[model samples]
Target: MSYSPTIYKFADGGGAPVAPEMALVRAVLEPHDVGDPQLTVGEDGSLRFWIRASDDSEAEISADETGILVERPQTGGVFAIVAELVTKLGAVIIDPASGRAVCRAEEQTRLPADMREEAIVIDMTGDALEAALLGPRIAVGPSPRAAR
Candidate 1:
């Protein structure tokens, strides 16, 4: 995980914020606001939060006047948090690395074809393993395990 955070903000119309300062703060903090936290305020006045991603994993989630940050993520799983902010503030994500739009469906589909095939082999998200395992690009067939 990089020390840098994955930011969420409006891509254009930069004069005013997407929402009121307080509402932006509330929207980002409210969901993760449970329990006491040793919050810190940066020189820029941004607030940082520490969150538990799982029993064995922990993460930092933060909010500021400009936008929110999901910092040092291991996987893109945490990107789901941006969905609410997108709806609430009408904000779009800027990929920290690419500096381009992040929330669009096309971004998700840009994975290489070989990786998509590996996903089928590993049963990552889609249910095409039954077909993928049968042969190259075959249509889905009954799972061999289903016969058991």
Candidate 2:
């Protein structure tokens, strides 16, 4: 069967779409553990992540200036990560095919098993998170997940 991409985006902050800010990016990714193909965010405001399901299906995530696009999200981990980040960033999960918000920010969505233990949802203020990002050691824990 064919599959559609899933998108995670910020609710219109103004009259326009908003991309994720650095702190939001850090908050969402720093404590996340995606195993081998960990999510990578570029200094230029780009992101890339690949997900491989237990069923052997694979998906790729791409980001534009507006939001994150998950291509062919065949795994629950895909939504798990999205749910985590959506809650953290105050964003929402968009069903690309329908162009609707399936999951709203801060809503209690369940995490998939593969991600339940690995995912560490953040509760830091922007100033605190920024501080942790700059310091020799992070307050959250070990250094934020390697971007590489």
Candidate 3:
């Protein structure tokens, strides 16, 4: 089953732009060293890194002037690692599910309706991630058994 990966944004206090440095990100992930880390910096000054778990699951994190973006296949505990890095960066975790930002208490705001349907929506404020994780599976179509 294919599931939309959850998105987590990181920001500093006072809503300042914070770019997660590659060095720091590497250091933070050293302990969980799965293998050689793949890091790249885009022309737009965005930093991206990919780390593969021993189980072959991979997690990718990208950070730009706006904030850090985390994407993982499914709830394979990769977020826990991302969460730790967020805490280390001293940045706030904006969980879209709660309607309010986490890591630093803030007012609740709902993402625009259009963004809510997009595969990779940027505006974070809800528990869509958690809900997807806990919610029932969505059947893509008729099962093979049914077809038979």
Assess each prediction's global lDDT (C-alpha) against the native: 0.43, 0.47, 0.48
In terms of lDDT, model 2 sits at 0.47
lDDT of 1 by residue, 1-148 (tens): 4744344443243433343254565556556444355455567676766543323234466666666666663333233343444445544444455343333333223333332222212222212211222223445788999988
Q: Per-residue CA lDDT of candidate 3, range 1-148, in tens?
A: 2332323333322334345565666666666555444446577766666755454556666666566665543444555565566556545444444333343222112322322333232222223333333353455898889999
TM-score, one value per model:
0.46, 0.49, 0.49
Q: Which lDDT tens digits does candidate 2 get at residues 1-148?
A: 4445443443333433466664665555444434343437666767765655444445565665777765665443444555555556665444444443443323213333332343323443322222222223334545556543
Kindly report which residue pairs in candidate 3 clash with one another: 96-125, 96-126, 96-127, 97-126, 97-127
After the best TM-score superposition of candidate 1, give how far the Cα of residue 53 lies from its true spot, in angstroms: 4.8
Where model 1 places Cα greater than 4 Å from the true spot, the runs are: 1-5, 11-20, 33-45, 53-58, 104-148
Model 3, total clashes:
5
